[model samples]
Target: MPEETPLHERILDTTEQVLRRYGPEKTNVVDVARALGMSHGNIYRHFPNKKALLDAVSARWMHCFTESLSTIASDSKVAPAIRLRRWFDTLRETKRKKIQDDPEFFQMYHTIAKELHDVVTAHVAELLQQLETIIRDGIKAGDFHAKPGASSAAMAFLQTTFAFHHPALLVTRVPSDDEADTVFDLLLSGMIAGPVSKKLRPKVKKS
Candidate 1:
């Protein structure tokens, strides 16, 4: 016998399909309910309202990205420098691929992400905490001499790479792989143990 999908998951799955079909502007609870072959009230039982459902969907989507990064962050076998590089590159690549691969779904979640400000805020906080962990590991490994505490240094690193990580900016101004690599090297050099030479810094091209 086939096992039935959980009701809550069914609603979320159907909602994603509906969002892909009708987009954020047009998708509603009723559409999701219809797609799931259930009454609107049934969806409401799991998700309070249309906005709540969309918020859940947005959270789910963002978590997927965070989970991927978390795996890299927790990998102790990788050197701090290489792990940091992979983390940044994976983040930028994952976001870019989402938009390029399924623009409709990306646009839908991007809209919901704005509407659910707290969700986005908490997501950023969680990612920042993960970055702090990575920075602390780098310090313990004698890779970074970040004078500021790990949390502060992590926040600064995130801010400096804002265009690459921030969702709204990511859609329009995501850095190229070469650009990310150059900026990462410059930033890490400043935070690395001991003195960094001028030769390590890449010269900025004139516009």
Candidate 2:
């Protein structure tokens, strides 16, 4: 006997393929059914409408993003800020390149861009909170600031403060990796009074 599969899971897989190839607007129940070799009516049985299918697709995208970021935060060799900037740059370049290289993907992305931004930004804020915990730990371990409640200050830091101000976070006019590191350090300077952020000013060298 063969393993039985669920209708919803199969529907989800079909929708992902549809979104990648055709994008959100063009991906409808009929197209989804065609991709899965099933009837249009059958797709409706699992997902009430096109919106429902796209909703599921967005959720899957979020879960995949979180898993990747979580892995980076766990790497023992890398500092929190370094790992974060790498991932942040990777994300901005990936999206910007996708838009530049593919028109259809670009259109599909704009259709869902606001929704995607909300989901991604929330994850970023969560990552900042994780970084805050690391910084706070360093403070308690005597590698950071001598001031009391310094750890709490790091926890209260705003995600936008670094993200908007830092060149590393910009999708447009992305600086070289070296420039990005400088920018990351600048934003982190005043924010971190503890061990990790203690070096507020690294002398900038001009070429």
Candidate 3:
């Protein structure tokens, strides 16, 4: 006798692949069930409808991302600098597998009413807030620059340097982890560049 595969997990796994390839519009229960080697009727037994399945998948993804971030933040064995770097690194990595890459996702959902779009945007906004909290803590500890407001600085850094999300902005002959670390250090410290000193500007002492 064949072991029964769990319906919810199968649906979500299928949805991930479908979102990457086809996006939301083409992600019907029949297609997902076909992917899982099950009948469409069987899939409906797990999820009431396609929209319910889509919403559940999106929610589950959010929980996973948040859980991962929370675990990293609480890991005491990691040094603060390494942890800080990890924060940006995780953001970069996540962008590679993001909602934006799923064309069918955007296409299918965008065609719907604005409510769906608003929900997606709100989810992202919440994640941004969670990361900003970490940045604020770093600032308070004097490890990160706190001049330009922690939230603003964190958003700027993520938006500007996260290569996975904004690949076009990432200019470099070599894009390695070491290279990224060096670049990030320069950006963070160079932000606090000191003012030019008039006395040190090749000035002759007045008699």
Best by TM-score: 1
Residue 127 miss distance in model 3 (angstroms): 3.7
lDDT of 1 by residue, 31-60 (tens): 888888878887777778888887787878
**Could you give candidate 2's per-residue lDDT for residues 83-190 as a string of tens digits?**
556555554455455445764544554456456666556655665655555455545444445234633554444343344323234334434557656665754564
The local lDDT score (0 to 100) that residue 150 gets in candidate 2 is: 39
TM-score versus the correct structure, for each prediction:
0.85, 0.58, 0.57
1 versus 3: better lDDT goes to? 1
The lDDT ranking, best first, is 1, 3, 2
**lDDT at position 112, candidate 2:** 67
lDDT of candidate 2 at residue 38, scale 0 to 100? 82
Instruction: For residues 1-207, write the lDDT of model 3, one tens digit per residue.
Output: 123356677788897777656666676878888888888887777777887677666656555555566656555566545665676677555544444465444334334323355445656576566556666666656666644676776577556565534323322221567767777786556434422356765776899
TM-score of model 1 (CA atoms): 0.85
Global lDDT scores for all candidate models: 0.81, 0.57, 0.60
